[model samples]
Structure formats: structure tokens, C-alpha cells
Target: MTIQTVAKQLTRTTKYRLNNGHHIPVAGFGVYLLPPAETFDLVYEALLQGYRHIDSAVIYGNQKEAAQAIAQFVKDHENVSREDIWFTTKIWNVDHGYDETKKAVEKIALEVKESIEYVDLILVHSPLTNKEKRLGTWKALSEFNHNPNNGVLQVRSIGVSNYGKKHIEEILAIDGPVVVPAINQLELHPWLPRTELREYLTKKGIVIEAYSPLTQGRHLNDPELLELEHKYKIPKAEILLKWSYLQGFVVLAKTSKKERIKLNFEVLPEGQGTNDPLQEGSNLGKIDLDPNILDALDKPDSHLVFTWGGADPTEYED
Candidate 1:
């Protein structure tokens, strides 16, 4: 991203203030490639550098490390309370439905060390909730929010991920989900901007969190990206990260390095904000995409991909 302001602007450090009263850091190190052994160290490094939010899910399988890092952070710093940490966990796709949803969330919360305190947020991991049991699953989450004991059900803000418009609408119509999902974690990057969905969500007051903000490191070689990297004197990756963030989206960036994590958090120069690589470039790629789990992550090479749902609102297109 390239931007211009006369006075010295604040560091590129940014956050997305969501509708549900939670502010998410626009940038933080990602952990998709991180093995369990390295997870804690990277997470500790992130928290020490002022990352308040950490996004993890059952599928990621690094929750234990992520949790340990947070607990250790609190022990290491009296000033850093658990309450100060905004931890996010998601229910997996296979866990969709009434009783399974209940058990899944319960297991995840407990896996993270059950606390009789407020949970930052919980998202329905995927949009593929069985049609017959979708409402019950959501209702189960709603109960989790209102439960007096706050056990496996300590979720505060409930939402969805990887859902498209039709799926979103279906969930929102369900009976009594008093809690509005505050976020829609989607696969967004300049090369594949979800323009239509972003516009819709902004109107609905749902914050969009961009996963794979760097496009899984696939766009770094593009000439347009290279040009911006040169123009801003930042790494092409930084240019991409800063662009997604500066454009007002909460970005979840993952890394397993102290230096790269620090480098990723560096402030971007001006003009990085207003420019859109996809907007003005005859790029190397096109936006025919699916919700792809990167090939290197032990998944099959070819799989149909789509968007994930978020905090449970409908009409989420793009």
C-alpha cells in the first residue's frame, strides 16, 4: 500500500473496531504453517509486540500452543490480564448441528482451559451446517452465550465463517439468535477482492476479517505487486498486508518467525492505502476462486473452494 500525508503519520499499526464492541488488530503473525513446537514461541512474540487478538480453531490444531502462549504472557506480565487478550476460536465443519455443535464448542472451550469469564468470540467454523439442524446448532450457540454456568458454552459474540450469501440469509432467519455475529472471516486479498460482499457487510455493520491476506504468498511475483513493493520501499508482502488493513478490514496474518513477524508489523509508507493493485493492474491472475486450504498443508491438490460464513447474518455475497 502507498499513501501520502505531510506530517509523520502513525505507524501502520491498525485495528478494526467491530460493531460488537471488540477491536481486532489489523495485523498479526499467522500460524497456518506453524507446527505445534513453534506455535507458542510465535504467539508469545506476537503478544509481546502488542497483538491483542489471536484467531485459532480446532482444525488449526495449534490451540494448545496458542493457549499456552497466552497464559504465559499473563504470568510474564502482571499488566497483561487474560481479559486483555481477545482470543477467538471456531467450531469445525464436522461439528455442525444441535448436539454436535454443543459438544464441539464445549470441547474447544475446555481444551483452552475453561474459565468462568467472558469469551471474546466464537464462530461457526464453516457454512456447511446440515440443513436439518442449522437452527438448533445456532440456538445451541445462543444458549452458550446465555448459559448461567459458562462452561463449554462461554461464547460471547457468536458468528460464522466461509459462508456465501444464500447460506448467510438462511442462518439469520433462524429463531432467536439474540447475539449478532460481529465478524465474517473471509478469504480476501487485492487480487480477489470480495467487493460485493464487503459492501453488503459494511451496510449490515459486520466487520470483515481477511484471512490469507497475503493470498498464501501467491501474488508476490506479480509485476504490479513488485511495482508497489518498490514504490513503497516495503516488501511486496508488506505492501499487500498494509493494503488490506489500510482499506479498513481486520487482517489475520500468520507467521512463525520473530524477525518476519516484526518485519510484517512495520509501518507502511503513504499511498499504500489508496492504491489497489487489482483496481489498476492487468495482473497475472483472475478471481475464479474457492475457499482453498493451501496444498502444502496436507490437503488434496484439487478441491472446490468457496467463502465461509460470519457472525450469522445473511445475503453475504461476493
Candidate 2:
């Protein structure tokens, strides 16, 4: 099907309700490569720029900064409460066992200076670790969902990142009742659309989070993307962001620049007024790309994973 045929309305207030009943904002600010020292300020700036979702990880070593920013932002904005923001973090590969994973979550809560209830989501960073360890980690996350002792909810939902179909199947086949993953964050762009994995997750009702949506700014100048940029009069980055939005995936855009942070949230068509792209009736809500352009962009070409290479779970299969 052509992209326009499937494209849906896009708004800054757009959200995807998880199977668990919690809602996640469609557009999130990801703090992947930001220095830990700069994370607090950058994240706080994004929050001020109308971003309510913040993606961080233990491996990224900026969970504390993100947490601090969230707390500070909520304090500053009277209308905004802790529940208004969605915070997501991941368990590092080193802490993959049941007890270790539990402790890891506790550490995150402590570092963030918020109770478990404040943390919206936690994910297994990847499936690169051994199978036993991976399952054990998931078990710990499941326990938190069931028992929130001392008024600490631990985490509202659990998910995985960079997991292929095999990894998901293994989790579903665990020996006993286990909490199904609610989301899977992956490096997705037109070049590496990962159509197979996307379809598999769609059938299972697992939400997909698109990371590195801009391909690390490498393909911004591509002739095809440039054409769309010119046609829509929007920046190449917005075109990429809109593509993922059109496909119904939560997109994570990372940038430290204040102006870019604000621009990233503005996806409305030209002349719609820049004050608020999320305003109703903005043409930016829907995108219509040519069928041939969609095919060229969505077709899998040479593998181009910018963040995690040689870490695909399928590659570990015997």
C-alpha cells in the first residue's frame, strides 16, 4: 500500500495506548549520545519545548540527569504533574539476571529521586545477552508489575530493544506465565525499514519505537529525501520523522540545540503558523508521499544500522 493510504493524523498531542492501558506520547525526545553532564539541561529544554516523553537508558548513563530534568520541569510547570510525563529507561547488559535486574530498577528509581510510580517504562536494552539471562531479566520486570510494595510501582510497563522475531518468540515461550512486552524500540529509517519485524510486532500488538529516525543525519541530503523536503517545504528531518509517524510508530528525535528541539516538535505544513504545530487542522497532521517514492524508501537495501551493529538477536541463533 502507498504511504499516504496508511498515513494517519499526526499531532504533538498524539499518543498510543499500550496494551497495559497506559498512554505514551507519539513523539519523544531521545537522549542517546548526549553527554551525561548536558542531559539535564537538554532534556529540560525539550520538556519546555512541548516534549512529554523522554527516552534514556542505563547504558547511556544519563537516567539520573533525565530524571532530574523531569522532576525539575514538573516543579516549574504548575499544570504539569509527574504523571503527565512519560519516562523510559533500559537495563544494561551487565545486569541481566532476576535479582540483578530488580536491583537495577531500584537503582534507577533512587537515582531519579522518584518512586517506582513515577517511572513510566523500563526495557531490556537488547537481546545480545544469553537466553537464560534475558528471560530472567524479564521475570524480574514482571514481578514489579504484580507487586508494588511500599507504594512503589517499579515500572508501569516492560519492553525490549533491538530484539528480532526470534527474541520475542523466546520471551513468549518462557516456561511459565510472563508479561508480554508492550513495546520494542529499534533503529528504523526508510533505508532499514525492517518490514518483517514491524509486521510481526504489529500482529502481536506490540508498539514500536523508532530510534535514530533521521539516520543520524546521514541521509538528509539524499536526492529522494531532498525531493520530498522541497515538495513539502519541510526540513528533511521532519520528513523522516513524519514517515515513522505515518507508519504508526512512536518516533524518538534527539538533539541538544534549543532551536532544533523546538523545530523537531513542529511538523505542520508551511504557513500553518510556527507557534504551535500541534494545533488542530494543521496539514502537518497527514503526509502523502508518492507511491514510487514510498517503494524506493521502504525497500530494504544494504543494511545500514547506525547505532548498534553486530548486535541483532537473529545473528546469535545457532
* 90-117 per-residue lDDT for model 1 (tens digits): 8787887889888887677666764324
- Who wins the TM-score comparison? 2
Tell me the TM-score of model 1: 0.77
Q: Quote each prediction's TM-score.
A: 0.77, 0.88
Off by over 4 Å in 2: 1-6, 115-117, 150-153, 268-296, 310-314
The residue-level lDDT of candidate 1 at 194 comes to 61
- Per-residue lDDT for 159 in model 1? 75
Q: Write the per-residue lDDT of candidate 2 for residues 1-318, one digit (tens) a residue.
A: 234533434567666767677888887999988999999999999999888899999988888888889888888899998888999999988999898897887788778746214678889998877888888899888888767563544578889988889889989998777788999999888877888888888778788899988988777777878877677676788778777776667899999788999888875222211111122222334454443454445646545676665355434563
